[model samples]
Target: MSGLVDKAKNYVAEKVANMEKPEACLSQVDFKGVNRECVTYGAKVSVKNPYNTAIPICEISYVLKSDARVIASGTIPDPGSIRGHETTVLDVPVKVAHSILVSLVKDIARDWDIDYQLDLGLTIDLPVIGNFTIPLSRKGEIKLPTLKDVFHKK
Candidate 1:
């Protein structure tokens, strides 16, 4: 059980990291509302297991930071499942995705040079379902993107 928990945690972390990496930018971003800051991205995941067992539950959390201090925090508990015995990543949750995206947009929007109140929309894409064949096969450690990277313009 301990091993499974650790693997799950690591998996979530990696997914989140990859999703926000600079190189991972969505091919095209559509802005909405009067403010261009308002944007949305969507994601989905599928899972496959050898035994057809229900996908293990995953919990995700979002923490907003500023000046190295936490400004807001939220969590998505066992948002969804990857489906049992399926060999694909499942779409788990969206709230955390939205929170992170909104936080990023809001940060840049607050800049004096940028006059706007951002209302962000987000989508998370679940790529190939990881190989969870072995009890300890899954890795869960991820280096999260800093607030600046998520919100700042390069």
Candidate 2:
């Protein structure tokens, strides 16, 4: 009986390992807004759902870092769902206080840009599979607005 159970477990494990699952990608991150006290950015997350049924997104958690310091991190609760057989784009917003950006003066002073790493976790509920999290990371540089950009008229 124990041997039979072990075979069943092994079979299930193999099937689960071969199962078709959803995939995610971090498409882009760009400046969204800027104010006197804080600078805000939006990360575009593209999730592709292969299942016929829609999968509910539990949350999107993100961390934005610069110069080895975490400038911003937070969660977006109930962020919505990945559409069935379709790709959905979700935006994750991050805001760094001016004080935090100011702390990276050395890095920002070089070439007038900030080198950054953005980490993201996308959690979704899969039928009969519990919750699965797709982890993604992106590294790039963002140029801060120049004085001319701030003062330029559209």
Candidate 3:
């Protein structure tokens, strides 16, 4: 069981590490012992803001891949007590910060792509999965597919 959990963790870590360069950076990731209690893990992602500033963050995501088919995971920002308010990664250029967030979500999906059926432990929900379809266009807009010619109806 522990071995399975470790394999899953490695799957996620490798996904992040393999992302296209200059857009994201991750390190200090640790997958602690796993059990029924919880799937504990810790790490930091240095997201490069659109302005090209490196924002380092410390986060822990709880993943219970063993209990449920779809695992739930979310990130918590630094308290800002140690790194100070200014250094907190969450505070940075808006677009760059957003890009970082988008990248994180994408990483999860990519990680889950591997050994998805075999593990059946990681489940990605709707909201998160929808994010995958959000296109990264320079125009900065998400165009919904048109079911009908609304413009012509009138």
lDDT digits (tens) for residues 49-88 of candidate 3: 3323332323322322212232333433442222212222
Off by over 4 Å in 3: 1-23, 27-29, 33-36, 49-69, 77-154
TM-score of each: 0.28, 0.90, 0.23
> For model 3, how many clashes?
3
**Candidate 2 lDDT by residue in tens digits, 69-124:** 89999998888888899999998988889898789999988788889999999989
Those runs of model 2 whose alpha carbons end farther than 4 Å from true positions after fitting are 147-154
- Better model by TM-score, 1 or 3? 1
RMSD of each: 14.5, 2.0, 22.0
Q: Where is model 1 poorest over a 10-residue stretch in terms of lDDT?
A: 21-30
Candidate 2, residue 79: Cα displacement in angstroms equals 0.1
Instruction: Give candidate 2's error at residue 95 in angstroms.
Output: 1.0
lDDT of candidate 2? Answer: 0.88
- Among these predicted structures, which one has the highest TM-score? 2
Highest lDDT model number:
2
Instruction: Estimate the lDDT of model 1.
Output: 0.35
